[model samples]
Target: MKSPQDWPEPIVRVQSLSDSGISTIPNKYVKPPIERPSLSNSFNNDINIPTIDFLGLFTSDGNNYANKSIIYEQISEACRNWGFFQVVNHGVPPELMDEAREVWREFFHHPMDVKQTYANTPKTYEGYGSRLGVEKGAILDWSDYYFLHYLPCSLKVHNKWPAFPLSLRKVIEEYSKQVVKFCGRLMKILSSNLGLKEDVLQNAFGGDRDIGACLRVNFYPKCPQPDLTLGLSPHSDPGGMTILLPDQHVAGLQVRRDGHWITVKPASHAFIVNIGDQIQVLSNAIYKSVEHRVIVNSAEERVSLAFFYNPKSDLLIEPVKELVTKQNPPLYPPRTFDEYRLYMRTKGPQGKSQLGESDKSQDEK
Candidate 1:
């Protein structure tokens, strides 16, 4: 159990694994100080996460209504059952997605000092770093990531934005706009499926035009002993929804269902969308926010971009009145987005939903 303060700066960046020129795993990276389940035989060949198509939502032909209805049903079922789904025919331009990945790959490959120019501190949580949790003795993930606060553009820290690749900033800005738009559309569809007004979620998020959003760009380099460590621990997301663009060549993302872990296959030119804890609370437990994690591989490096959509910091989140009834009371009390963020930081990633903790506190009172 080493405290974060005592955990010395990582001696080797995972990205350097490719250039180490060593044919074998190093002693330092061989075993994690904390013990975790061995993943050597965890793969299940028969189970896979569902992939949904969004092309029906944007159709202009006379079949638009019929197609939308079918798509809506699929989304509703996926959210209620798995809390995760991959979407194809999503509107994001494929070229833009490729460019975003290229820019980030270049940025991560920069010299150590160059990448450290925008290093993150324990408190700020925005910039390039591998440290994610604040708890002492917490098992660290085997990856490096850069976090950027993209929404409420006025609140962005301009200096923390990387400038090395030069094209990084411009490409990211464009990608953010597209992602935000797609999120709004997806929220509307979810709201309709839940039998609420189409704009219910958008309005709750302070209208479709204004909302808080953030992006986490992750780079998981090849590991010498992949079975002994994890790329990211199992945990549910804390925001409203997350749009993940995963590496096409590597497969690592997995979700827990019925006490079994199922691999999520990445779809070409599509984004994986999953409901977050807030959305489950908002839906009064009708939908779920399931536990999911990433596995590391010995052969290939993986890159993923996750865009988290959230309400304004001060917005109150709770079960919608329409979804609550005498027969079904709100499962969790109202909490502001800022309060939830603080709670998650203090608690760290423990493979549990914070909303469940809120329910327990309320029950005790």
Candidate 2:
């Protein structure tokens, strides 16, 4: 039995595990005794999640007003109840989505050295790596990922970006532009649902040029003991919102609702949208930032692209004034993006949103 120190210096990528041709969970990959569990036993497949159609929202005819109102109501219900929903006709060209996935698949299949050239480090959030938090005895997840900061294009570090698979950069850049626009429009609808001006939420993010966004491409390979390990640890997103493009054929993402773990099935050309911790705080806790996790498959691999929309680093986040009155005071205190990120780095993902943890820590202090 080897300790975590004996593991590879840079940490082994999940793709390497798939390439080894081994059939059993390696000793190093086995989680701590206290953390191990039968993942198969926790699933509840009876509940059906909601899916929203965006095609009607973009129409220019006489029914547009009615369609927009209905769609806004549906989105509000989903956010308040489940904090998750799927959107079809989202306007991101299917061809571009397909090409983006193809390029990423090709990039991940490159030689280990090729991927390692852009390895992530403590100082930078971008690049390729595994086991983000390497604390001793920690239960590491079973996924490898490439992360890049997208919005505020000026903040992008050209050196940290991957230069392989040829078309990887081009496809991602174009896709990012489209997703950001779509997210902005979605924010407007959310703001209107909350009885605020159409641009209230978008404006709070520090205008179009100052907002921040990140793109994370995740790859989860088949695990020998799938029931004993997780593709990702259970946690809630710390940003404002997330637009996720999951593999159409594979399923592993799950959300916890009413103490039951429900699987999120993928729909053709649809993006899974979930409210994040910041959004919950901005809404004064009216909207939930639900806990979700990924389970590994034993026979097939899974991949997903997650776009995290956030506010500017210097922007202070707090409950919107309109949403906070005598009946509903602010649920979370004001905090900057930098402060929130530092808290998440220290606590890691542990089945709860960072905002909740931050509030608890403040109360205790």
The alpha-carbon lDDT assigned to residue 252 of candidate 2 equals 84
Give the per-residue lDDT digits (tens) of candidate 2, residues 86-183. Answer: 99998999999888877887888888988888877544557886765445556678899998988787877756677887777878989999999999
Residue 9 local lDDT, model 1: 46
Model 1 is weakest, by summed lDDT over 10 consecutive residues, at: 1-10
User: For residues 1-365, could you state the per-residue lDDT of candidate 1 as single tens digits?
Assistant: 21233224443466665458555655544445343436323456867678888875776777688878888899999998889999988999999998898788888888887887777765657888775666554556778889998888776765788996988888998999999989988998889888999999878877765688999999998876777767887678888899998888898888867655677878798799998888888898788888777888877888899999998878889899999999999888998777666666656565555666432232222
Runs in model 2 lying further than 4 Å from the true structure:
1-9, 32-41, 357-365
Instruction: Please give the lDDT score at residue 210 for candidate 1.
Output: 68
List clashing residue pairs in candidate 2: none
Which residue segments of model 1 deviate by more than 4 Å?
1-12, 16-43, 357-365
